[model samples]
Target: MTQQTFIITGAFLGMLAIILGAFGAHALKKLLSVEQLKSFETGVKYQMYHAIVLLLLGFNYTFSTSTMYWCFTIGILLFSFSIYGLVISDAKGKKLKVLGPITPIGGLLFVIGWANIIINAL
Candidate 1:
């Protein structure tokens, strides 16, 4: 994606992260178990973290390649979205075992993206 696109996406995701975090803290606190709430918070944290990464990458523009951009974008989608789905599903007494495997794949992509950033910096 283009730098402008990344920036826009980052801003949107950052906004969403804040919304989700607040929702979890206020609305979900009573509905979910402690463990589930923790899981939800994890999702919010990682989403915000990568949202910042996307913003930084967008602003830097020339420092990283499309591969780095895509890794973080796709990683956030897979990792954070899967966690959100899983937590909600669990709260609803449903199991989404399929999404469990995807979270690690997303994490791997994040690692790759961070590695790429480090390499580019050097």
Candidate 2:
């Protein structure tokens, strides 16, 4: 995807994260268990983190491209979205199971993205 596309996606994702965060705090609290609430927080945290990275990529358009952008985008979507979905599932009385390994992959991508940026900068 182009820089603009990913950047906009990130912005919208950021807004969603904020809305979800408020929802979790005010609304979901009474409905959700403590563990589920923590899961939601994880989602929001990752979303906000990647949102900042996306904005930075946009600003550093000249250098932020290729693998780093790809890693960041994928990591944001899978990591953040999974957390959101898991929380929602739990809230709806659905069984939330950690069947596959996702967090580690997401973290790896995040690290790679940042490393790529730093390496490119040097």
Best by TM-score: 1
Clashing pairs in 1: none
What local distance difference test score does each model get? 0.92, 0.80
Listing every candidate in turn, what is its Cα RMSD in Å to the true structure after a full C-alpha superposition? 0.9, 2.0
Cα lDDT tens digits for candidate 2, 25-83:
99999988899899889978887888878877876678777687779878877777777
Worst 10 residues of 1 by lDDT: 61-70
Evaluated against the true structure, the overall lDDT of model 1 is: 0.92
**Candidate 2 residue-wise lDDT at 94:** 83
Residue pairs with backbone overlap in model 2: none
- For all candidates, the clash counts are 0, 0
Compared with the true structure, model 2 gives a TM-score of: 0.84
The TM-score, computed over Cα atoms with residue i paired to residue i, of candidate 1 is 0.96
Give the lDDT of residue 77 in candidate 1: 92
